[model samples]
Target: MSKQPLAPSVADLAPDDSILTPYDYEHLGTYLNLLTADAEVTDWREVSRVVLRIDPAQDPQRAWQAYSSHLARAMWMSKLGHRHLLGDIPSLH
Candidate 1:
């Protein structure tokens, strides 16, 4: 079987597209990690540093934005985005 894509050290602000995008598919693991971190009551700044490779101490705004947006997208995926993943809707690109 093919290997799953590895989570990236850095990620762009998560997409706001109505449908799932290629970026979402590639960052699936990252999204899940974000969800887990939230569930575990992990601090957002710490999550940013560890998971996204962003230093909140150096760039508080950037780190917060990245963590916030990514976590929101992760929740979206858990709610409604999986329907897109399960369907054969073409052109995630």
Candidate 2:
């Protein structure tokens, strides 16, 4: 029997048009990491430039909301990873 090739990962796929630029994705990933590390820290002024690059008119309220949502997702993923590490859950294929 022949084995089929594995599909590409999500990162391998092109970003959506709304998130086309590399800067956008990079900032997003950084923001997610930081959020996961410390949800209380909200000093995103450092990434203001990156956020502006993606949408100059991005409002602070919207940005905070988006960041919060991203943080939640990251936290959930981290918890899952911890569970897998502890052998409470199977490793994700």
Write the residue-wise lDDT of candidate 2 on 1-93 in tens digits.
553223211221223232224322333454355454465554554333242222315566555555454444445444442343344332223
lDDT of each: 0.86, 0.39
Mind giving the per-residue lDDT tens digits that candidate 1 earns over 4-74?
54665556588988899877887888899999999999999999999888999999999999999999999
Considering summed lDDT, which 10 consecutive residues are worst modelled in model 1?
A: 1-10
Clashes of 2: 0
Model 1 misplacement above 4 A: 1-5, 89-93
Candidate achieving the largest lDDT = 1
Off by over 4 Å in 2: 1-32, 36-42, 45-58, 81-93
